[model samples]
Target: MQTEIIIAGFGGQGILFAGQLLAYAAMDNGLETTWIPSYGPEMRGGTANCTVIIADEEIGSPVVRNPQVAIVMNRPSLDKYEPLVKPGGLLVVNSSIIDRTPERKDIQAALVPANDIAEQLGDRRMANMVMLGAFLANLPVLSIEAIEKALQEHLPERHHKLLPKNYQALREGARYLAEKV
Candidate 1:
């Protein structure tokens, strides 16, 4: 199975790190994975996007022109990448920043109040992880346990102590989606 996911947001929102975590989890799950990030001056306040591909077979390219999932954390990101998502793909929107919905009818969009959820979790910075949880719940390619393990391995040693809180944030986001769907 091949799944291509695009995550976009402003700098310092953990958009790239979220993509990396997904790729690492895919690798830990014995799948081939690649993470391609769009960095540079545009990433300052404009837009930062990363494409992550996970497949049971070999991946042809790390860059994704059309992804199976688009996780957008800001209005600019949603405006830029929403149309690029493949038909029948999932679009995870951070409702805290985005007010509009995708115009496409073929794709399914999930508007998650990531910032609000993270605030409720006592750390607004975990908004990315909250979105990741929603992604896992909708995608179902990897288990929550695998993602938790991947987080533990991928986070820096200094940030290791916050793993449990992040996991809880993920669970809260997943539960929110579960209740909705």
Candidate 2:
């Protein structure tokens, strides 16, 4: 099976990092994966997004005009990607940053309060992890165990100290499940 995902938000919101984490997990699971990152010249506060494709066979391309999953971390990302999700796919929304609910009903939606959950867990920057957690829980394309291993094996050594907190954030986001906004 194959799964295509897009993670998007402002540049500083860890959009690329989140996609990298997914790629790492896919690799750890022995799946073929591709991660492509994009951003605007405005830098940190500007638009940033990444596409991740995981499959059992060689991926033909990194470009995905319509993804099976979209993890949008902000209002603008939501606006841009909502219409692009494939019907019957999944849309993970960061309710903490997005003010409006999704208008599409054909796809499954997970409204996670990522920023709020991260803040409650002691760090607001882990919102990306939270959203990723929600996506994994709902879709099952990649196991959380695989992601944890990726964190331990692939993430930089200096960041290892934050693993516990990051794991907690992931769990908390998963716990949210299919909550509606």
Candidate 3:
């Protein structure tokens, strides 16, 4: 299977990190993967986005013009990428930050309260992880074990203490979808 995804949010929201984690997970599973990150000059508060492509065969390019999956964490991201999802594609939205809903009906939409879930987990920054978990719930593209391993491999040693919380956040997101569907 081939999946092209775009995860977008403001700079400090871990948009790029989320894409990296997914790519690492795909690589761990022996799938071909590519990740590209983009951001404005004012990183901290500016818009940030990343494109990730996972496939069973060799990837031809890293850039994604029309993604099959969109993980939009904010209103602007939703406004920008919602229109770009391929028909019948999946759109994972963070409802905690975005009050609006998807306008398109041709694609599947999963509204996840990622920020609220992360807050309940005691760290709002983990919204990305929550959203990631929700997005992975139905994709079956990568296993949670692979994602956890990727986190362990990519996170700095000094931040290892937070791994458990991150894992919890991921689980929480998955749990949300389970209960919803």
Candidate 4:
């Protein structure tokens, strides 16, 4: 099995972190994976994105022209990547910020109000994890437990105290999506 995913949003939205968590989880599950990140110069307000590929076999390329999954956390990201999703692919949108719907009709779109949910969860920054939860709820590629474990690996030791909040955010997002579906 192979999956190519693109996660995008503003620089401070933890877009790269989400992609890194997914990559780490894939590796933990013994899958071949690649994560490539890109960002603009404006730092917090600039655009940031990452491409992650997870496969059961060796990956041949890091470039993803048409991703199987696209997680869009902002209007610019949605506008840029929504149409690039392959037919029958999944488009996960952070509806807390994006009100517009995708133009494509061939793919499945999951809308999660990630920012709002994160705010409710007591921290707006966890919105990325909320989006990640919503995205993973639909795909059985990795278990939630695996993702939590991967999160530990990606976060620095000093930040370990915040893991519970992040874990809760992930579960909340997944629960939100499950209810929506």
The backbone clash count of each candidate, in order, is: 0, 0, 0, 0
Better by lDDT, candidate 4 or 1: 4
Model 2 regions lying over 4 Å from their true place: 178-181
Off by over 4 Å in 1: 42-44
* lDDT-better candidate, 2 vs 3: 3
Model 2 residue 177 CA deviation (Å) reads: 1.3
Write down the TM-score for model 2: 0.96
* Global fold similarity of model 4 (TM-score): 0.98
lDDT of 1 at 33: 96
Per-residue lDDT over 24-67 for candidate 4, one digit per residue giving the tens place of the 0 to 100 score: 99999899999999999987989999999999999999999999
Clash pairs, candidate 2, are none
TM-score of every candidate relative to the true structure: 0.96, 0.96, 0.98, 0.98
Per-candidate Cα lDDT values, in order, are: 0.90, 0.92, 0.93, 0.93
The window of 10 residues in a row where model 4 has the poorest summed lDDT is 138-147
- Over 4 Å off, model 3: none
Give RMSD to native, each candidate: 1.3, 1.5, 0.8, 0.8
